[model samples]
Target: MGLTQTQKAMVEKARAAGGSGQAIPLSDDACVCLIGIIARDLGLSDHFPELPSDLPPFFDQREPGSLNISGVEFLPLMERLVKLNPDSDTFFSCLANLHKRRLKYERILQTQPIPTIEQVGPRGLLQFGTISATTLTGLLFWRKWFFDIDNRAGQETGYLFEPIIAHAIGGVPFSAKASPVRRAGDSRKGRQVDCIRQQKAYEFKIRVTIASSGQGRWQEELDFPVDCRQSRYTPVLVVLDATPNPKLDQLEAAFLRQQGEVYKGESAWEHLESVAGPTMGLFLEKYVRDPIQALLNKVSDCLPEFVARMDKDGITLSVAGESMLIRRTLGAADDEVQELPDDASDQIPGP
Candidate 1:
């Protein structure tokens, strides 16, 4: 169906009128920041039925805080979007072409140009700069499975050990959507292997942590992937800002070493060759840097120098940013700091 001439004109009119309510025009960076946040808020689902119009008022806040609109309650939501660009990119990148079902509009639109993940899972890999946390959260959210452990029995060290074990046996624990098969028994001990491996499996050597503050005797734990015996499953590692308690990273590392030692003669169970970089910092950096950088480039009137300062640490744009940051970091290791700049202290504030 094609958009009726009347409908097309109406949409154009609405879009044109979209900014008139703006008391002050948003910077290019600000606009993109707004869109990113808006997209995320929409994704959250608690606040439903959002339209383009809901954003201008939020963007209109020109407060002297970390962001262009520090007074706005939605600033944190916006910041999360900025901080999770790679995840956001991966998400938008995965979306297919836009389609409208209206009988009035006949145009079948191709997806907007977004970066593509050439190889993901195992053969395909992608990077998350400052947006590491966001990317991980997004990966979990997108796949319908966040990193959940068995806190009930506390037997699995309060983390999901089954999936970790599966990672050892050429199985990949993807977000649920990426799972090859979904059955009633996925959460079970033995069933996970069959369900995960039945589809294409990619291994993520994630730096995982477990806290004992809330649960049982597992004081703290950190685990890192040290073996890729199951390379047939896509293999990648997710590094975090700090090591978890009980030295899970060391444990996994030792496990790999032990495996190598044990199977040295029998078969190859070698660790992966790391293409090292600033893993944790870059992840957070991408979260804010990419959005601020790109957004500044967009607004004709936006000062790049001004937006650059927004990336500075120890800054909080709005109360919302503060609260949301706290929520996201709730279960994370205490040592991991929110590296993304919340306060644009150097920019002389926004409004």
Candidate 2:
């Protein structure tokens, strides 16, 4: 995920340009056009490099000048996908392409060890225990399907509400529906209230999977209530390195085809929640933004370094702004798994 010689030069050129003191706002289409130019220049066609472990950059210095551009920073390029000549095909095409790159990044991290785990059995039992004796609230839910008999066709009708719930909470429903209230005055107790109340509550139990790493596994389940009538989710999924802890894990979800089956399985919600502890939104904040501040260390010219990394990490240009100051995280370290090329030094010679 480091920068190449060409990318380094591109950024340096922009640094020398002395840009207009205005932040340029590009639509998703503009972002893609920029990325297309970059990809071609980088020779990323037949094969693109895997994204670096340190992804989703966060930038701080919003200066009053034109920002630099480079091929290595794919996120800015990707932001343009929504801007292609014909919107429909390009938008989806951009998403699918980015998703594929994400998966490659996740696979790279799955093999590394930040913590350990042990698989118990296939009744689908696994365990995750914290290193220190600490209490952590792990959320859980289950994925389920209920069928009711339809009198008209003498066939069963499927209830399709669970997926909507799943998309929102990112966990299976674990809470159970309340029992139906007794019919109004069937016996002779007292009141005759003629209205029937329908209980629309359901819970999903999540089953978890643990790798064979040698460490005690902690297990817990939680219930997330979903009202299909209440909300809608922007069904997006991201794949990248990083192990799933009680707090978070990378998710591989899709709104289409078999990939959607990633949400299937009985009470597998427990497993889903174990991973769900972490959301992509959270990563967008912590990993990208926090890290940028940590890298800047309050120095100004070094701001460009932060910018290059930001573009490398996929920090949306629009969101980071043109001139903003980033404060360093209290004790952040350079845990970068890959090293960026010295784009600042390597420039082409003029004839």
Candidate 3:
């Protein structure tokens, strides 16, 4: 399949920023870097007899106290190695190891401090100036409470929450309600999943009940699709609330017992408290915060298992100028893009 518009735009931007004619495509640098590291860590040549002698040179290029070879240069070498032993368990293990290393590197980057105005040169300053202007515009736009009244009414009908949650979690909303297949002699009903992130399905529930019977019904709602589609995607239940419901603990436990997952108001509150402060944290946790933190936690927990499974299954590894997008989009629909909330006014303080 061809690259999506967003992917194409990224390539174009990279080229415009002097990334042209680079041996490694700008986008695949991190993956390629991790690939080299993983290969050395796994001792691919030593373990896999089929590995070509030239493969060692790629890893040998690492200089002490200096940058390793660019992913661009490493790409063809990796591709050749994969072709040499396409079905080797040791080869696929390196790919899984690469993913693990990349995840750790990304976590490190997130924790690092942002560059200051002086630290960033002229180009960086220009980028930050645009970012600051956009942020201020967003703040002023959200300052309008009067416009939110109508927007809240629209939200109550449950038309916009899925897109909002999907956007916040960096996931795509599943367009169709139910899978194409139907249970024998049973009428097709709408599936509850609203959004999907990292191969996990998420269903959003607003104002769920605290009673035992109500909780049972909610559990059923969350579990059915997961039971049916567990092989394809893991399931997460996100319960949006106006207040902290103590009974949700029971529901969460029940879902977890069934191999399903749950994230409620309390989880959102805890996340916001860390990032947005106590006051705004309480407000957002009660009102507009999406279950992004919960979804991230789920992804982090699942990734190791996912990598192991991929390695065992021997997923097709391509290092020749392919993007990480190709690795992630293996089973997902490329056309199904995540939709962002149309207006900031859509968010209103809950009672």
Let me know the TM-score candidate 2 reaches against the reference structure.
Answer: 0.18
Give the candidate number with the greatest lDDT: 3
Which stretches of candidate 3 lie above 4 Å from their native place?
1-157, 177-190, 211-222, 225-231, 242-250, 269-287, 290-351
User: How displaced is residue 132 in candidate 3, in Å?
Assistant: 60
Which segments of model 1 are wrong by more than 4 Å?
1-173, 176-231, 234-236, 254-284, 288-351
Quote each prediction's TM-score: 0.23, 0.18, 0.31
Better of 1 and 2 by TM-score: 1
Q: lDDT for model 3, on a 0 to 1 scale?
A: 0.39
Give lDDT tens digits, candidate 1, residues 255-339: 4442421112111112211111233123223332243345545556543331101122321223323321111111221121222
Candidate 2 stretches greater than 4 Å from native: 1-239, 247-351
Among the numbered candidates, top TM-score falls to 3
Clashes of each: 44, 46, 2
Given candidate 1, what's the lDDT at residue 114?
16
RMSD, each candidate, Å?
22.2, 23.5, 19.6
lDDT of each: 0.27, 0.25, 0.39
Question: What's the distance in Å from true for residue 305, model 3?
Answer: 56
